[model samples]
Target: MESSERQLRAQMRFFHDLVRKLAADGDPYAKVLSAPDNPYPAYEAIRARGVLYHSPLNTWVTADHELANQVLRDKRFGVRMANGDKVPEFMNFDNSMLGLDPPDHTRLRRMTVPTFNPRIVERWRGRAEAICHRLIDDILAKGGRFDLMTSFAHHLPTAVIGDLVGIPEEDREQFHLLSREITPLLDGVVTYEKSVSVHAALDGMAELFGRIVEQRRADPREDMISRMLPLVDEGSLTMAELLPLCMFLPLAGTETTVNLIGNGILALLRHPEQWRMVAEDPELAQGAVNETLRYDPPVQTYRRIAHEPVELAGVTLAVDDELAIVAAGANRDPKVFPDPERFDITRSSRNDTLAFSAGIHYCLGAPLAKFEAEVAYQTLITRLPDLRQAGPVRRRGSFIIRGLQEFPLSAG
Candidate 1:
């Protein structure tokens, strides 16, 4: 199994290198990195090329808000090839519903919806609040400067999702350690070593969840795994299907929320007036969350492949042609938003953002993620009224997922 896996990774690495060459030599992706802290200029270049610009790298790129929404909602565009092939040339990771197209996509997604129902997720609010306060207390106890991403942002969502998914507390550290390695593949820039690490992390997580599945089958509890066990037993969902669903929760829940907190806080701090606004009125926490998502979303790029020749943005996409919908750029479209560059929590047009994306593939845990950020930010502002940046920020090295990997902050 290990040898076969290594061979698969060798193929993936070769493919990644080929794609990198294509992107660097010909694609807009080559020019998309304006700076570690800002990629909007790169996105602006793509937008300037017109609504639908064809890349020499053999993909169609769009930063237009209407075009992005049309492509996402259009039935002709999907996550996979027309004939059902996976598109992860950098890593052999399958995102379940995130990878599937309708009837299959609809079926699998429907089964998971009840688990993430607004009411069910709302029940997690108290726990999310408690986690926020406990983390703040610990950071305060340590006295002066701490890495916000590591100390608070990363751990909070990991624990919340861990609890929600019913992973045994003793086993969660190993789970998170592995997830940390695997999440970067979302960026689509995988080195040979990183691909190997991702494979190992996925395998280890599968094993951990496998054990939990068996435990839930034997001694049912009030957790998500237990809730879904009956469906697995009766064949509404197979064991094979169950594992990925369990894996998706944390995979979906963690890094995005972590980045949201880190990026949103940074945005607020950079615009001190906005920070003061949220700090003064805790009610603006949700407004802050919305504005940050619009200004600097966690997931920066979304992809779709045409299932058939489809006319869009005054051009027809041949079957299997990839569409790189840059939502980060779309969120700032001046047609939809005035002064698109400014980060304002009070802007009425702010809700026009495509941060959680649009249409069917929109984030399932968006409510939970929003609530988590709200609580984290609200608590931080109220408790650490004097919070300020202590050191240089290190942005994550992936254009697809925009976030700060390390943000040093101090509370006076």
Candidate 2:
């Protein structure tokens, strides 16, 4: 334990010093890492530098919409180094599909495609709507004021994902806590306290899911875990692979939707005109979701490494060069989105947003996340037509997984 603690402290100091060094050097991407609350200015600075800015951190960065899309879709780029090494400091999802390249990524992704495909995800709409109403019922009981994030936004995705993952209702709270603890690691920003919490959370999740795995082996159920157990027995997957896959599903599923709902509602409330449009005609809920995704995305950036030498927009990237693709910046590029800074629910070309990323690694859960947010907004506007901000909102300290930490609201 002492040795592990020392290692954790050392790692934290290293990242802190690295961030300070880069920030001092005026590295725009590093500015986004150090102070992420309003990264748009730094993104604009990167755009000012040109299509591709080489950061002191040695990664090629881009805020250009077309170039970002080209890099994400290009077969010459991948999530790993050319030598097949995983990027350091990223969440240890290396065992899961999120960290794998082709063949393995294709294999694991294919296994779960049916589960998150639009048709199957659409089947969960009633359950999602019911969950939303139930959460609002709790919010209404709070005497017209409450933290929307904890009382509603957070619970909606957690409950839905909990049910889908076959976690018992009694254990859902613990599951949510562990998932939140692990989310900060996504940004590659680590403090000593966060490091300790994340380690404990990972251990807790392993124990919790291990028990479920054994139970499903004994008594098969109609859920994601039980469905995949056959693959484990058939030599297609091992216990080593199954545990990480289980962990990845809840982590990825919950965080994305939770942030989507929170960020979307926050955007609407900040722009009352858009809020009024949705409140007056809830059919515009989908439009509200699309606009929210473009205006303030849940995920701000993703990384890709050149698997081979590639030329993009007058820049030559050598093999193994890493690029930080700023999706948030790309979503707001004027070339693709006119008046990109304005949040308009009625925008016609909102679908061009890279909010869910692009190409082979496009979010598998995008359909489910959008459906849940659409249901969430529609339900909130219909039930709490007077919903508005009740206090100052706090954004989470994660740059990669952008979201709210506290969002107080009044049902009014």
Candidate 3:
């Protein structure tokens, strides 16, 4: 048997023991970062805990690309691995659109589609650059010293998503906190205090969306929330369903983009030639973005259960056994992406990479993600001119979302 395959069988026994320990006295935080230096290396040994890669608690960590395409495409298999009793655990249920499938997903997606249209994306071209400029300026004004994660990568996406959703300029912080709090990757390891803050953020979002929905009902605006709020007024959308859309959009919108930008920058800084390539030929921004997604996908894993016995890579999974589609690992799978680890942006091959996933559940925010990164990096290379990493940076203590927590950069 192949190494990965052999490891899978061994994990069946090893993972159960690990889970038993974790259930009792394991420190989730310490266990998460136990192999922070090599996060992906240990994934093979952990997936056999009932077919789903169980984390210390509420874990979804996989990186296989083709499986991602299969799982994401099969809409019947939704996110049902939750352990929420008081409320749907992991992601707050709250009757959100994400929990709804088919007619609901179709209807909500139709309403949400207008905001992501090509023309609307074109409208944000300047807005995207403007946000980039504002962020870069903050760094420049600070004498080329800034936390790229907090100061730039983190702020721009929150601001941009806010602008898209009709959030007022002053209220961006609320959205930012919500984006961070709601990501399982970030808060899965949060303490009781952070848990309080996460709930507070959810409450704030619900309240904010209440007003926004009401405002849009009275007088529709050009923003996305305005476009979708009418359905609610017409009784087409209810609080239970609508709350998730309002919160999910910003969190989904900004969360991954922030990580993508941060990861892309770090990857390029590590590979100066690639940086110089983008710096020289501004057009390479798109390909560079694609490569970044393949190299270190922001959302590492998505899940699906076998409706029937499924044969994936010769591994026969039993019916109803949970399967983790590791987008990051899939992106690196040699079968799909040749020389997966070299970080070569110019290497052209079929990009069936599991970054955005595939099929019906393919990331709804993909068009937005690609557009945002293309615009942001194009501007970064051209405007910043001297963007370079300052020192060693750390990731956001997250196993699911991949990116740096602190990226210090100097832009001359």
Q: What tens-digit string does per-residue lDDT give for candidate 3 at 1-412?
A: 6795455445444544564466346433224434254555444344333233445444343444455566677644554422312222322333455544556667877778777777776677788888888877776778977777888777777776777777777667766766666665232333334445667777887887787677766777678777776676789876677666777877876888988888888888788888889989988888888888878778775556555565655456565556556666667766666777778787674257777767655676777787788877887888876787777888766656777778877775
Q: Per-prediction TM-score, please?
A: 0.94, 0.95, 0.81
> Candidate 2: where is the Cα deviation over 4 Å?
1-8, 90-94
Candidate 3, 231: how far from true, in Å?
1.4
Winning candidate number (TM-score): 2
RMSD of each: 2.5, 1.9, 7.7
Global local distance difference test of model 3: 0.66
lDDT of 2 by residue, 1-412 (tens): 6997787678768877887898878889889878568899989989998999999878899999999998889889999878888776433333468888997888888887766778877888999999888888887886878887888888888877776666778878888888878776565666777767877888898898999889888987767788888999999987887887788877888888988999999888888888888888988999989988998999899889999889887888999898999999999999999999999989876559999999999998898899999999999988998888988989888768888889988999
Clashing pairs in 2: none
Clashes of each: 0, 0, 8
Please, what is the whole-model Cα lDDT of each candidate in the order they appear?
0.83, 0.85, 0.66
Clashing pairs in model 3, backbone N/Cα/C closer than 3 A: 62-326, 63-326, 63-329, 63-330, 64-326, 65-330, 84-89, 95-240
Model 1 Cα lDDT, one tens digit per residue, 44-68: 8788889999876567889999999
